[model samples]
Target: MVEFERLANEKASEYAYRYLKKNIVGLGFAPNSKICESDIAKKLGLSRTPVREALLELVKNKLVVVYPQRGSFVSKIDYDLVEESRFVRLVLEKAIIDIVCDKPDNRFLEKLEINIRNQKYYLDKENKMNLMQLDNEFHKILFEMANKLQTHELVESISGHFDRLRNLSINTIKDIKTVSDHEKIFEAIKSCDSVKAKELMEIHLSRHKFEEKILREKYSDYFD
Candidate 1:
């Protein structure tokens, strides 16, 4: 019985983490909103212990912060962290592009083209959530092509924050521009033009700084 209880608690903790991440990333839980472990426990029909464990995991991910006596709250967007993540992504992606360029694998290109087709299908269906997931998958496939699985996983972990910011940016006219930018990147990669691919990626990643600035100004209330 005790072992069963332990296993249940572990599963509950994982569920809590997923719930919190989805709500936070979806902006259902606004930034700096007080998150009570007991409340979450009650809502999920679970014990407070598992909820606490889940909250601890979120804190470790820098998604939430715990106060001594007050409670836990979602963390504000950290621009520095965003910039750092962008830099790390650029370096890793550029290295991958170099590998692909040197090898010029048809298999990689075919897989990427298939991903793009899937993305278009989702877009046509107006499935925003699936589109977002597929878009991330597209990038992940690219990194996998270069055999940077670990690096891709690291990026995937923090990608939720970037996605949230990107959601806001896509609301603007710049979203259309982004499609063109992506096309250019794809063209460079497909042509095995490593230099052009790297240049396009640099431009693509740097554009996020502008988007971040716009989002901050537009949604100043959401940030600290």
Candidate 2:
């Protein structure tokens, strides 16, 4: 079930959107599962209007599908879209790596180190969701250091399908090397090694492709 946590200052629709998107991306509402606006509205203690608006926004992001007669459903993961997202993110992140390598910041480096440490802690505890969130924060900090948060948001907007696959991977794959991968990337950045950083980023971003066959065979219902 999708859980809701109300935000004190956010509007109803904004709150609904964030809650719904998180659940969808996290696979709480599995791919292609039906979504009932009234049910969601009731669950969130909001009216249908805000929930409907939120659903419309999700539809725009390709995270939700609406059928004329059947109603709304969570969008299935689309491998092609995931590929395109990876390509776009790789290009942008490589650029970010170049910026970071040219002028590494001690402040951000420390933050990255802390993020990695926390990731390792969560990894030891086998807390996949927390590890996943930390993994995202590690990359987000890189963009923040590069002064390209807007670009990161743009990537995120188009990367919903990729995000779903990533969440699924974190949950289903036991031998996730994300922490190690982050360590390597962090070392490259800390050493101001643009060449190595870009290389590692490419390999890291492309990791999903290697898992495609296994994931598809195991969870055929999750993908389009």
Candidate 3:
């Protein structure tokens, strides 16, 4: 009975952490908004202890910041952190693309094409969230093909920040151009033009940096 209780608490903690992280990434929760442990516990129908434990996990991930006397709040977006993450992702992705170039597989290419088709379909429907998810899936498929599991996990763990930024970018940027850029990437990959594919991917990733600048100029209030 005690073991079962412990397992249940552990699962609850995981659930709470996932909920908080998703809400934060999806921008469903405002940055620096006060997050009450008791409120979360009540919402999840769990005890405060498990929710507290989950919050600590979020803090460790830099998704949430806890104040001693005050309550916990979502972490503010840091441009420097986003820039650093972009650099790291670029380096790792370039290496993975190089490997794929050396030994390209049809199966991997097929999967990528399928993801691209799904992305196009979502874009046509203007399903931004699904499009965003499929975009990530396309990159994840590339990394998985390269067998960079650890690097993929690290990128994915911090990808929430990037995801949120992309959400804002999609809202502000020209939709057609963004969709066309993805199409270019898919075409390059299909032709086995690794160099072009890599270049296109770099452009796609850097698009958000441009959006960040525009947001800073036009909507500074939205940022931290």
Candidate 4:
């Protein structure tokens, strides 16, 4: 599969885990918000035991902080974690862009074209969440075209903290700019301009650098 799909058959615990993870990473839970297992169990129509297991997994991901008696809370965004993952992602993505630039594939270009189209459509409607998903697919598809999908998965897996930072930073970034940057990278790849593509990809990944301050100031409680 090109993307991570929900399993038609997931155990109760796995279902609870995925459901909570998406909301946490997507900013629905909010930074440092209370994570009430009983409340979540009712909402998900599952028992508290499954929700408890799900929260444990989230804790390992650093998305949830558990304190006995006090209860669990959504963790704050860690800037250092964001930079570390961004470094790994940029190094690998730049390599993939270099490879694709050298051997421009029509199939890959078409896929990106479709992604950019959807990005624009969502941006126009102010559907930021969908736009964010397209943003992820845009880069994941890059690695897929080069058969470096594992690299993308690795970057994504280690990027949970970075993803939260990005979720917060996106509020400060204009959606049109994100779409515009993707367009430039797409054009660079279409023309087989490896240098330009690499350069554009670097800028795309470093957005957190400037937006970090803006996010912290806007949502003071969300930052670590």
Best by lDDT: 2
Over 4 Å off, model 1: 1-10, 42-45, 120-127, 172-174
Q: Which candidate is the best by TM-score?
A: 2
Better of 1 and 3 by lDDT: 3
Model 3 C-alpha lDDT per residue in residues 1-224, reported as the tens digit of each score:
00112334458888777777777877777677888889878877788987899889878877788888988998877776677778778888877877777777789888877887787787766547777777778888888888888789998787666776776776566653566776787677667778987898788778876576776776564466
Candidate 4 colliding pairs? none
Q: Per-residue alpha-carbon lDDT of model 2 for 1-224, expressed as tens digits?
A: 45657878999999999999999998889998999999989989999999999999999999999999999999999989999999999999999999999999999999999999999999867558888899899999999999999999998899899989998888777788789999999999999999999999999988898888889989999988
Error of 3 at 180 (Å): 2.9
For residue 50, model 2's alpha carbon misses the true position, in angstroms, by 0.8
Candidates sorted on TM-score, descending: 2, 4, 3, 1
What are the candidates' C-alpha RMSDs?
A: 5.0, 1.2, 4.8, 3.2
Cα lDDT tens digits, model 1, 93-174, are: 8988898788767887787777776766655454365665666776787888888888898886776566566555555424
**Candidate 3 global lDDT:** 0.75
Cα lDDT of all candidates, in order?
Answer: 0.74, 0.92, 0.75, 0.84
Judged by lDDT against the true structure, how good is candidate 4?
0.84
Residue 197 miss distance in model 2 (angstroms): 0.4
Model 2 residue runs over 4 Å out of place are: 1-4
Score candidate 1 by lDDT: 0.74
lDDT of candidate 2?
0.92
